[model samples]
Target: MVEQDSTFLLIIIALCLIFDYHAVLLPSAYNQTAISQENETRAESIEGTLIPSEVERFNMSSMDQDYIEDEMNYPPIRECSILEEFKECGTACEETCDDLRQLIICSQECVPGCFCKAGYTRETKGGCCIPTALCPLIKRSTVCGPNEEYRQCGTACPRTCNGIPEDCTQKCVDGCFCKEGFVLDLDKCIPESSCRVTEVCRENEVYRKCGSPCQEICGVQKETACTGCIEGCFCKLGYVTEEKAGICVKPEDCIPPKYVKCPGNETFTYCGSCEGSCQNQMVSCPTECGSPRCECLARNNYVRDKFGACIHISDCISK
Candidate 1:
């Protein structure tokens, strides 16, 4: 009976010791976690990552706490690898070539670390960052259009069949573009020889000094009439222009003739034969009303396109 009583007392004592041990450790652990959280909370600003408390300060005046004035010393910058600089607050997500294959959104919060300098990115984890031009281009099974290929730094303003001007102000960018001696046409790269800028116009299409966009057409209406005269091929005097295709054909060639009355841009005339298309236009022709039709005048800058359609004279191809 005594032995049993002693054993129960011993077990009670052991339980008390265990409770006291946990009670003593719980507060300590809680204080440590709270301090750590408080320190992290202090890192609100971007400039300084850590603000040292009195305990954290190494050397300080005893009587008066004059903190360490050295800014660089407080935020110790570790030695970084080549091509890296210490950023107080910067993105840690360095996109690698392999990483680009999948989409991974990175945290936007301030992350202090060594990052690659501008114009550089890592090809892989722990690898040095390099310029995109130097990076191995991701290969594609598909080929570019005819007379086109990918370039590291190609012109953003490619020359098209219309002979659009190159934008000198634009910086070089990467992409597929026409190779030398070729031009872009309808989004396809073709030999410059085949482009309309150099090719011969079809029959009845004379390379006139001026052309009119307000000329006749099968079916279409222009939003903005060609303001000034342009240089390009135009239809002869006998034929009018097909509005939609910009092709030129005889007045009788108009399909259905549903819109035979007049073009939206042109004013109908009671006297068709002498209405206009005159070199001097209205001034030369007197009003002697007769058959009705649409006509163009030189002052309006009317001319013909390659297909013999009337176009703005300014559209004429330059010699």
Candidate 2:
């Protein structure tokens, strides 16, 4: 009876050992192998964060409880292999609180809509959020800056620029007029030193020089002195006379003419003239007549000279 009892006890102990090995040890080993493979796959992705969608997929998979528990026991995987990466995933590390508060650095050419923390402005250089240290602050829903003029009369400002009155409000800076040397013709200020003098056609009839005044100048109607000559009959060349004649004449003719008696004819001489023919090329003088030629001059052949001489112009030409 003792020997039978010993054999039965030994059989029972061996069965218990086999059952424990298959149930616990084998499954544990398999779970470990699966978890190791999972970690290796996660390492191949770009970002260093686990994808939540991938975790969902993994939980939904038919993996056994032993494998799932083994996965949950380890630290969160650094990456995800099953799902695509989240675009707006926080750049900060969850392990550190400081990283959460700090804004992410960005490339110089980053586009708009990039992630930035609140209380920061998108820098002109990059889309990165920069502290609004120098930028205008919004107070009472108003934006005012150092250089810019502000008007806070109402919810919507009565006007935009501050310095000038509302009626004359424009984008003027400094004084209202153009800078020195420059005339205020255009909308913006320009260097007046470059401009030239005005073009004056006449004293009162001054017109801006061609391409000047930057606009039209004193019109013809403004010049009352140029009345008769308005249509255009200016004095002859080498002349200096006013436009009083209403007609232009030689500069010398501007004054009255003098009268003299025709030497031989005793006729008044307005201008030099001769009757038929006269000797000694008579010139009209009040008291007496004078002549250079002693012999009589031909009437037709020898025409009158400008000085009332009866000498032929043909003779003069021939001579």
Candidate 3:
């Protein structure tokens, strides 16, 4: 019994020492817990490494504030204002120094000429701005000469030249013209009219001058009215004769009669003539050559005798 008790006492003492070491007697357990918590906290801190600050940011100046001056430069020049110019020009303060300034001045106080396109011309009361093509007056004098109306046109278009104040030379105006027979025409001097007589011809007529009177008036003959006159004959005032096939001539002609046949077989046979079939055998022909049958047959055949009688061509030739 005593040995069992002693053994039990020793076992109890060892168990108590182990419990105290783990609970409070020794620091191993607490140290391990502290180390584990420190490692966890360190890992968490490393995960969020970046730091923020409250410092202010630097600023920059604007481009406009850097290069621009606070004041205007240049002298005042008095000149005509161009309608299209952005700024106006004023009196020049000083000749030499002002001239060097950005201001531009003209010889006289005059308005600027109108705006001209690249290839156009612009004229103003003071002067003109002409393109090379629109107005070729660049090298030419403004005034051509005395007594000229046209202004020497230059490379500019829509330009006006001095009229009557300057005479037009070839170099002055676009063109020059003079009256007929005068020395000058279109900037060129010419001779007078050479024709001695200027004949005026009327409608349907042309001027004809021939050596003989007959030759002069011969052109007036109508082909249908007078095919041709006999070799030795001339056309009469009111009537004309035509040459037949060869030698025969129309001494008597057919004319419109005063009266016409009204569908009857017999006519007045005088003071009238018929063109159609003369069924009216007695109708009178206005020409009064002779009997109706005789005149009709004779005119158609052209072998009629002077008395309006029809004769056979062979008989007439034989006679």
**TM agreement with the true structure for every prediction:** 0.29, 0.16, 0.17
lDDT of 3 at 121: 31
Candidate 1 displacement at residue 22 in angstroms? 39
lDDT of 1 by residue, 139-244 (tens): 2212467788766566767887656542244665656789899988768888889965444667656553345756544333322556666667667665666654
Q: Write the per-residue lDDT of candidate 3 for residues 114-143, one digit (tens) a residue.
A: 232344333222333233342222222223
Best by TM-score: 1
Residue 169, candidate 3: C-alpha displacement in angstroms = 25
User: Over the full model, what C-alpha lDDT does candidate 1 score relative to the true structure?
Assistant: 0.52
Candidate 3 at 200: error in angstroms?
Answer: 4.1
Best by lDDT: 1
Which of the two, 1 or 3, has more lDDT?
A: 1
Per-residue lDDT of 304 in model 2: 48
Task: Report the poorest 10 consecutive residues by lDDT, candidate 2.
Answer: 211-220
Q: lDDT for model 3, on a 0 to 1 scale?
A: 0.30
TM-score: model 3 vs. ground truth: 0.17
lDDT of each: 0.52, 0.32, 0.30
Each prediction's number of clashing residue pairs = 32, 7, 24
Query: What is the Cα-based lDDT of residue 152 in candidate 3?
Result: 34
